[model samples]
Target chain A: MTERWKRTLVAAALGLALLLPGGGIARADSWQDRVSAGSAAATARGTTIEIAMLDRVTGQYRDNGPAAHTRIESASVMKVFIAEHVLHQRDLGKKAVTQTDLADMSRMLRASENAPANRLWVAYGANGIIADIKARYGLTETGPTSNTRYWGNTMITAHDMVVFYQRLMDGSGGLSARSRDWIVEQLRQSVEWGDGGRQFFGLRDGLPREQVISQKQGWMCCVNGHIYRHTSGYAGPDNRFIVVVLTREPSGRGGAHIEASITAAVRAMFPEGLVPRVQGQIGEMWVRSGGHRGPLGLPNTDEIPVRGGAVQYFQGGGAYWSPATGPHWVIGSILQRYRAMGYETGRLGYPTSDEIALPGGALSRFQGGYVYWSPATGAHAVMQPILAAYAAQKWETGRLRYPTSGEIALPGGGVMNRFQGGHVYWSSRTGAHWVIGSILGVYKAQGYQAGPLGYPLTDEVALAGGAVSHFEGGSVYWSPGRGAHALRGALLEAYQAQGAERGSLGYPVSDAYAAADGTRMDFQGGSLTVPSASSTTTTTAPPAAPAPGAPTGAGTATAPVAPSDGAATGGDAQP
Target chain B: MRPLRPAVAAALVLLAATGCTDAPPAARSDGPAPATSSSSGPAPAPPAGEEEAQALAPLPDGVATGTAVLVYSGLGELREPFAGQCSHDGSTTRIEGTADTARIVLEVTPDGARIDLDDGGVRSSSELSAGRYEVSGGHLSLRADMTQDGESTGTAELEIDCGG
Candidate 1:
């Protein structure tokens, strides 16, 4: 076979190599033949750990067979099915994306929003997501169901996962080749879960970055005695090798053993197995052995206790509370929240129910605790484990939308930062001192977070932003700025203010931030937000530029608003 | 298909004459020009960088990448290598459909153009040429081509507003 085809075969071999419970690289026969005999591997494992792989080069499929139908929870793997179904419509010209559609899909794929996936499900049902895969790429066994038995009802077997990946690669996923490439790219780019639920240990475990592995994992404490760990991913230069693993019982702590086993098996199957492994994304043994963890005898990471069944049990209404801290659903401290989310370390922004002091011993209210999900809006739980957003939505639930205001106890003393509009306000006890930032959806600032998060608005703070008010950065900074009304009113003022310009782009784009001497900062990949502190900043983009056009700047000067959240405006849908 | 080539070649010549100096880009984001009717055929591409040069511009909301679905007129017929100084006298148009709305504009210059949509927000642009252009609901059929036709080259089924 040609080198290209041979490499494809090698990648596929690695995915299936791990199917054998005790079968390390040396023992597994030609990986192709072994994988082709999917049913053998199904019964081959002690506990029946069936793994299926797809070779994108050829439309042919490999399934560990009926074992894939035992119907494991689809978990986040469902997101792939949803994406395929949606893209299929896009390719067939059966649907047009709305602003909401893009945003929803983005959250589903990038953030793995469960509710949003459901919304898209209406149009792209299993028949659609699955049928498209089968029709286009000849994918079989990866079917869609209204719900799964596992976490939040999204489940599929190891065999099915491979089938889905197969469909994604060969146009059977229902998306155009270009769309398939995009989906693969997004899955590959993901390092950690946007929702903090990335417990799957397959790809990140035993691979190299150059040979990026795109995968997702699902974990839930099963009542049946097994802590299930299900995962699926694509590996390769062109994402030719697809692997899926669904475990009946998981190893202790974070299911790392399951991941390690898969990783060890995959590692041996490639490079060392006479597969002319490309230099890309290969496991570097020295790197693995080179480093030691931390001074505390703990791996360089903090030993944050894992609240295992918190989201799993309470995903149905999980309440969280520490022994010392009583009766609270979320962990209040920012740093503590990250630890709660399984991160030994993370950025700040966790909410503690107890009052704690800030950088300067200021007491700020931090309530606004609530679990919000909307088929209309994505799911969000702004309380503990640090205020993180989830891929949830308001289906039959009420649209309280983040209780609006609340208070939290900080560490060490009185309080930390005040909270409002999705930001922490550093305020002195005196009313005169306060700094709020990156407010959600530009509403008039509610004066200051005097009351709690859900404080009833007597008359709606004379806030800024909306069809009317227009402010530069995210905060109210100057008079030259258009009032919320000015923004929505005349075309001139409207043209000057850029709204939603600073939200996170799924990827980087051409951005120009002016420096002190008019030296514009132009770089790639990093995201920039208007300092919640700035007022007179201006950004210029072509309101009339067309395709195939040369580029530049000149005319009317306008400054656009940056989104408080780190997401771009366009995204995919969950439903 | 071959029978239409001669006419297509002749049409190309005519298009080049009128369209050589000015043409829109591949797709527009500011909606259609004032002169364009709602039912008018797809707009042409305005020149690149023309929008910012013409109007001081607002910071772009974001940049998006897309393939060229259709090239109706003007620059649509040219093979210029991504660099051509173009301004408009109405020979081509750049039309595009976003998540919610469709845009049409003209390239008054290589850097900017006069937009006629609710173009009051931060917007962006791109350059693409390929893919079949399909715009239904209007009356007009034009073939894809090469020869340069003078002024507003390809036949766009635009209604004549004589009252103006």
Candidate 2:
């Protein structure tokens, strides 16, 4: 299996390198080629790929695609859902699933026991299971076949499976950030072992120590003359970016082969810098918050006060995502690329940049989230759409990536290619219509030398739209005012606000005065009062609160916020 | 009502707006009191910042207050019920378990505070742990701890309000 990975990487290295002639920009073909190669070489025959990439940064989905809607089979990946759903219900003031339910899920997922799966299925029943899925999971294409009927032709598709994994990973809904955190801790804390299945190295290989991958494997010896095997889980942070591969009619070592292949294929998308790079080896990690992340890798702090979260960095050491350690961790892991991209750290109130990645393609980028590209081979780039907020730009376009930054030089070219109202105006030496930002698009096609007609889209809305752009060799573009937009989602919000462009909004903008194609967005402060039946657009700036007396150093903030009798309520508790 | 001319009317209107009960008092009720505690910071804010100090005050009929879910995020939600019950009984009051999700125990005294919670019921023995919580209406807040004892064990918060 390891040899297969080496072969693909070696093959890809030679062919893919020249594909992306420019050092930074990636060609989309590279990503697809890597996926195709891993699928073909790693798994012998029937195995297929089912991937669902979420942009946690934007809380939007880049590509649900065909597999997203299909109902194939939950297999072990369903365990994550069961674990999260069971726990969320408990937090929502609903009765906690009985220890019996937990034990059943644990045995089924943590232990890969069919018996416990069956027991829980019977106990929860179809309606019971479906209710939790709908309520806690917000799943669109999933329902129970009944506890008794579970595994009785039980089926789920790769796409729906991805959603389930994502939902399990994201517990922010109806739950505190800490709540979802505990779930992540649980997923990571538990791992399956014994029976030579331990060192399988399928999910373990490829990434760094931060990813405490928790997955389930299934082997089916059909009644007829056939055999099938499947495996799925979050190959990276939060298990939201799920990868599932299934192969039928395989050889004796089918489980191991398929398992290893799926990891490789997905890992190709993760690249090097994407996954949380846990500092130190396992057991030596500095795990914080979710100290009790049993088996699911969800956050759950025991005894110690949960650090309302931490300043996460995509570094090697620390707690959460520090798979080297046990379940003790919380806040988010660091996405080292965030700082490299030039985003100000300690802002956004997030603990780590680990889950943050540069959007992969049009769909992924517009999905509005952060993504990470390996500073190394750049073979893969993992994306996590922001939940509601997004980064319009990487903290910096060029400042050299971390650790190895000292060795390489970053051009620091502004990541954004200026376009007028969705029309390309600057940057890109090639195509008449340039593709920039985290997406690719046909710009106005009008080469401008400057002034009005030359600047047809100068502040004017470009009839063309904008999207997060993806290239042939896996390179992603981040453009806000271009021929790309999120249609309507968090990615659009992020791209417009944090796009790598100099003038992009540093913070998320609530309202935008979008022009014809929406590529042009500006804060009018108030509604744009377009004349009746007229084509011209006019807007008035919203009235601003009179600025407080410019602070003369001794700005005296009254104690309307009284001190907390020494406890220090952080003074937010105004009676 | 007709204004007795522009000048008088302006004065009256200003008085009315500022005088209405919905707004906070326009001026300091009394001069700052001498420091009541060692860490002097304006005499402990006249003890009016948190509503608990007014526990003995009576309310008009039909105007009872309790915490409610005033705002909600689409997939997000948070709720905090005020300390109507706790205020009347000093800094401690046992809830009948409206079964709120914050999973906290509210306590107040003169000095520090203590909050206790075992995320997801995954408890262990440890020393002091840092936590986030809110306290308003003279009631201590459990800073949105998001976990549950998936088993039967419940998590608790120990808050030490001032007025110890």
Candidate 3:
């Protein structure tokens, strides 16, 4: 009947629709399968390929066979180890690296210059360099060539390279942060034209720009009748992942052919680039909603499982999925509110609908409640008996307006909500009712519900001459002729004994106040005074006959009944 | 000078016919070539540098003498003549030679021989067919066509004495 109810029903229907069989969008392939298949296809091309991938966040490592541990010629990749050893020495102040040394290091890293590598290799003995790096990085299968004169002959395995990179990134490789970052920065600036030849093969050319690659490449021919092409690097945000591809093709393959083979292998592993793919039902919904460029933005993490289904956080928001709810995204302030309420484990449960736009703001519905947001009021949850009361009053369109805060517990086992228009109070004894206008002002003057007025028992009722709202202690009456006032305790009893509003003393025009004698209430016809509480007296015009057609007892004011099921019935009402 | 043996004269004729007349003698060899003598007491010892070069070679067997000529145009122009010994254990023969800083290692198998050439800093590898071999005067010579990236780049000529 109300706008809130209509929106809730619509959300419920959409949630139900998401639960149908095959409701999820279809995807061509999962990322894991695609990467596995791609790796296999590349290996089948007559190259002995070894791959190692490390997820920095999860500390999970993946590889495509024992070749990751099989040592091959390091080629120019040995330059990285050489650089690390030199930098570590520099870090310890054991060696003063001059500006010339820095320039040479940069040349060696960015351009893969052999002269600089050879110079550094001799300066820091080849055996010492290998020994230092091996001990520092715990490389199990990396060693110097028997003839240390040929730095390119240093043997290294993909697994050891990954471990070296991981240690370098985590600042445990005996290099200071400055040294580590410098090395990584030089790698990031690697040029396509290195001293040996084209360097932008494999990860650099194969992966998308989204991967943010920083790499070192190695290529050398006819070491034991095999040509080695290796690409190793940091990929993804903040270098959150490491990828190493080591390949050795039979001798005599052209440089371009070998490089392309490595690149194809890398491309196969990451068809969608290096940003982890969002897959399955969540991925389908993401595409439907515009994919990486959509409102959800790019997925910052892989789909992670929760209690019921899974959730994947994107740059824009988090997409949550469940068998019952399909997929839905909660964004902005509403998402913050839901998180504060404990996410899916909280009272609100999983989102049943995507954020729904309203005239002034937006709302997202959940199993237990709704998180509503407005430019002026931020976001807050609305649930249960209070929601029903708000729905009966037509939600935000009614007098209560938008809720300013979530349900807050009172000291006396009651709950209260502050709204733009007024306040909603709920207690087991008093049900749920809103206090607003001048009567609320008078109740505030009497210390609100916490004072003698207690909780509101009924909403304001319109009388022939004024309005009235009953509270636990007494009642507040409002009239244009005498303003609003509260009548309570002994004074209220004395006024009722003289027939209350139907008696000679009409609706109270002034709240009960402390006088020189005791507490007093001023009415239109007369006043009721309780001096010292022991006795109370009412002065009025001669007991006038009840006004013709005047109602008796508590008038027509009725308290809002709490919902039987206690389920939220409105889109934006607070509990 | 002592007269050339008939086998050596015939091998020289074969070498000239095969466009190897320009092949230079071992200029950087450890010693002068041994003179031919009529007496059959014992043979002379080989050059001094040959023993060290043979030890350094990545060969499976003992040393053998060889003359190597490599002509390649890929990466950069390389036309070099190296007089050195080759080595073979049994199945594979490795002929490694260096002219100044440029070096080339040719590994010959029954199927094919692979040439790993490094002319200064520019390097390239190419596979060549198992060449035609001729043995005369206790010397064996191999002539093969070298192909790189599936394209014929040049030819490699090697003559070695493996004591067969």
Report, for every candidate in turn, its global Cα lDDT versus the true structure.
Answer: 0.36, 0.33, 0.69
Query: Tens digit of lDDT per residue, candidate 3, span A187-258?
Result: 999887665256777887777555578899887654445666789989865897788888888766655566
Better of 1 and 3 by TM-score: 3
Which one is best on TM-score? 3
lDDT of 1 by residue, A437-539 (tens): 2222222232223311222112112211111122222222211122121111122222333323122111112323345533231112122333223433333
Query: Lowest-lDDT window of 10 residues in candidate 2 chain A?
Result: A559-568
Model 2 per-residue lDDT tens digits across residues A89-164: 6777675567677666655555555455444545545346556665654455665543223332245555455455
Query: After TM-score superposition, what is the CA distance of residue B101 in candidate 3 from its true location, in Å?
Result: 13
Q: Order of candidates by TM-score, top first? A: 3, 2, 1
Sorted on lDDT, best first, the list reads 3, 1, 2
Candidate 1 chain A least-lDDT 10 residues = A278-287
Worst 10 residues of 3 chain A by lDDT: A560-569
Worst ten-residue run, lDDT, model 3 chain B? B32-41
In candidate 1, position A324 carries an lDDT of: 35
Clashes (backbone N, CA, C under 3 Å), per candidate, total: 143, 144, 0
